[model samples]
Target: MDPQSALPAQLVRLAQEESFSPQRVLDAVHAALAPRTGVRRAEVLAHERGRLVVVARAGEAGPVPGACATFTLRHGGAELGLLHLHGGDPSTVDRAVGAAAGHHLAVALRDVTTAREQAELHRVTDAVRRLFEEGVRAVSVEAAGRLLVAVAADVLGTERAAVMLVAPDTRVTHVLGVGLPEELEQRLAASLLGRLARDSPAWQRAALTGGPDVVDAGGGPPGRPGGGVHSHRLRSKLKLPLMSAEGLVGTAVCGDVTRSRTWTPADRVLARRLALQGAVVVDNARLRELEQAHLRQLEHRAFHDQLTGLPNRAALLGALGDALDPVTGDGGVALLLIDLDGFKRVNDTLGHHSGDVLLQQVAVRLRELLPAGATGARLGGDELAVALAGPAADLAADLARAVHARLGEPYVIEGRTVRTGASVGIARAPRDATDTTGLLRAADEAMYRAKRAGDGPRTAR
Candidate 1:
């Protein structure tokens, strides 16, 4: 095609191209100008991170044979960089073509920059989504909070990230951190709290209005009065509130300590996203914890004596059953049932409260006498039960002696001193009876026999 006819078309095509790229536009400019202006080379340099970076260049750049022209690439009235044309002069055609190419390059560079930023934002959004999913999947509050801080640290590219949960009394609980020492993390939390008053702007915004607060101390000297001491070595700080429908539950803190950092809009957005998801995870974990605690309490109440805090008859039977399971019963098992002696007289004289205290004391002595692989439980008023993994004989004798010694010593209930003795009976699995019910019955019968015969202890037949 003739150069004159092609020039207008080339310029028009460059103008109309939707897929704008810095290098593609530079190449097209060189092709169009080399033919018309006899330009041997063209180069586009863009300013990046305080320096000019060569973005695209076309044709060999040795030396210009004629006049060379350089034009600044401007976008939105600000100079982006320089566009240079070699072997060129300011003839009306050269100037017009160079200016037009410069304009295209400027617009294309801006488009590519924006596209890059948008792509990055999408990636960050995806990552934040995954972080929330992991937090939600975590089985415990500690695990969830750790995941939150770790993810925040990685995403923010900060030296330290931490989570602080506030209690109703304004005290902090469960302070956790990533990339920081436990002691230092604790200190950081303490220091931050010391600076944060209930009425402070950060607290008010986060707890009341649900806004993020940031403090950036750009790589400059510390402005606070105490210099290195009060600054806590932190140059930049970002705070996001962990909010729920009930209000603020906690705060997430991101800090840059090694160097100062300018908080970008993108960084702020990331902080907010993390806090929003983290709050839900934290709340869920806490609620689960409360539920678990409630369940444990119910189980305790169902299978334990409220007065003595010992396993009740039901729990004792369940334990005996477990010990006598066919797979594990080879070890053999022993059951001891004990009844307090002369306990009715103490109750009749001193009152039921004193009886209750003496029962509690008897329970404690039984617990002290129990060895490893043995469990102590309360059968009911004035009666106790013991289950041991090994065979009885010597073990049962030792336990009976210990209980007699401890119970015979004395009891202090509501500042009153009393005395009592325990009648213990022994039953053995496979020897006396292998099942829970049979073992309990044998032990009970032996205990009664001991009491009636005035014997210190007795064994089942």
Candidate 2:
């Protein structure tokens, strides 16, 4: 190969090799030129720390006065180094050779920079994957949101990250954050998303569009901040919408507190993914709460009377059984079974609708007369039971009288006054019967006796 052409070839080889070191390439350049061109000596000199240094040198020259030629190499219009030929002044071919080498050097530097960036990106991607896995495993929405913000802040290399919950009422309920003081984070969220809760278009755009956006407080163009006041000292923001099948749930916000930051594509992608995960988490939480509420309603219906909102027959029986138990049962339980004497007469005189109103009034009176630690339940059809604890037999008798009096009070049914009389039969645990069924049977018998005698109250013997 021609001596001048070989220099370019050497540059190509160096550029193709991995770990392209400037010193190594310079050494190769010198070695290739050593055979011809009377170049007894050659060196690659480049500026380092504001001073030129011989990066690579080959061969030796005893003396060469005014015989050296320095060829300045440039890349991307920036001066990088000079190729020094020591044997004699260079011709056009030597200058061309140095220019080719400089071009390859520029390409090599660019390749190295690209490779480093790619490696860093892969690391960031791995972090995101780990975060995704963690988010998927979280059982609660709050927990999942916390994990997302923490992971997103780390992955995006941002100052702060937050998950803001946008309630259906268009209010910001909760702000979950990472790497920020609670007060500042709250203020920051309120400034950005609080506006969304009101009449701000930024939030609507993000939520309706269901994508990520970068907003600069300075109101400058993309990646540039010209001049303006950053109201919160927040120079830049990246926000994405939290969405579910229902609609937009909330938003995931990331802020740069120190400087004006231009969000990269990777940052936007991470925000979108975090928002998506957050939506799923928030939706699941809402669904779980709704399910729990429905279950509670079912439980209430199962144990309560639908008509009067009191404990029904089955529930009262269960409670009575519990009261009869030796352990975990109340001390000295008194059972009173009351039957309204004139309830049937009232039902016949007025309509069943009026009967229902009377029954409701009766329930209310029974409840109002019940003492502390006592329970009132509607057994069925104007027959109600009351269980009281820690009261002597005499006190139980007095309570039964109070119940009768309360029930006997005038009830306004369908815009007319109505009256009823109550017959009470009282039974005490261990005095009447220890078992639930026996106690209930004794109470029932006593109540019938009260009705037969046509008295106010009767106690079991």
Candidate 3:
């Protein structure tokens, strides 16, 4: 039970606990001193913020002399603090116990300080991860920026936070945040970040070099320009360059009222991690938007004919089925089939290109001539069809006549005027045939009947 022997063991135990507060260190020191010989009470007093503060006191006895041990927790070879003991008789063993306890206490306090720093680093890392995950839900750049600012404020222990993004071409900075002071926000939006976006050598250097940098209030580093450039009167600042594979994206700046807030190596590491995650989220959102747009275009193309930009065969069939189901419950459906009589002659005389133009022109005219309830389709080659209700044969005849007249007009195809006519066939549902297949067969037979009738239109009963 030698005090010196027990001292190292106690210090090791204290180090393992990972408690680094001043109060915890003092408590450990008092506990170590309590079991030593001739020691009634032990107290530790240290200078904190230029004032003597009692960090730890133990034992039910009175206070000891303040000058017993001499140590200051200041910089540059300064002693840590004082350890006072009240007891009966002074001996070599008693003095050894006090010295040993003091030594162990100092070591314990240093370990505690290191542990606190590590714990703070872990906390900030976790927070940044959460922020990045939450940012994934952001639908726009402004929302993402606001999330970044909120995360920064929580991690850095700042009263307010703001995020600024530099426009690529305009070189203008935009403020995106949730809780920002009015004065700082206005100044940053109007001058500070905007000026940096406009022309700050430091910002430009960091952006171009693709690295991180820091600056303090009152223009801590020289070489930066004045006026709007020096608008931010921050006590300290930390700037990180945002980058992607293509190039630098932008810069992330954090400021606070703490003097030149010296960044730890851990802080820099965490900041870089956050910036990379933010970049990924933004990139993913953009990719999703592009994919949605591409899918819409493909859907539109799938439902329409590429050449005529009208409903194609498949769409026409689907429309026919839908139209027949309701009208079939009553009388039946009606179909009109039209074949361009001399379209092949035009293709042979002009060319396939001119033929395609003539077909498109024919489609337009047919669409205009058809009734409101009629659906039209280009069924390969020069064949076209229109479908309507069963009781509309007279109306169908009127449409067929109009279509024949329209087809007879001269078509200016690729600067060459060509004339064409159409042979029409009409078939009525329930009267000609009941099912869709039979009705289409009847219409096709009637169409050839009209063509054989020598340029006159015909209808099948």
Best by TM-score: 1
For candidate 3, write residues 186-284 as lDDT tens digits: 755665454445365655676666665655444465334432223444566666666655445455666665454555566666667767765555555
| Tens-digit lDDT track of model 2 for 388-410 | 76544336888898987777778
Q: What's the lDDT for residue 388 in model 3?
A: 77
Q: Identify the superior model by lDDT, candidate 1 or candidate 3.
A: 1
| Residue 221 local lDDT, model 1 | 41
Q: Could you tell me how far off, in angstroms, the CA of residue 22 lies in candidate 1 after the best superposition?
A: 1.6
Error of 2 at 174 (Å): 6.6
| All candidates: TM-score | 0.81, 0.61, 0.49
Error of 2 at 260 (Å): 6.1
Q: Rank the candidates by lDDT, best first.
A: 1, 2, 3
Query: Which of candidates 1 and 3 is the stronger one according to TM-score?
Result: 1
lDDT of 1 by residue, 31-106 (tens): 7667666778888888653457788899876776776777889999978788877885435454555567777789
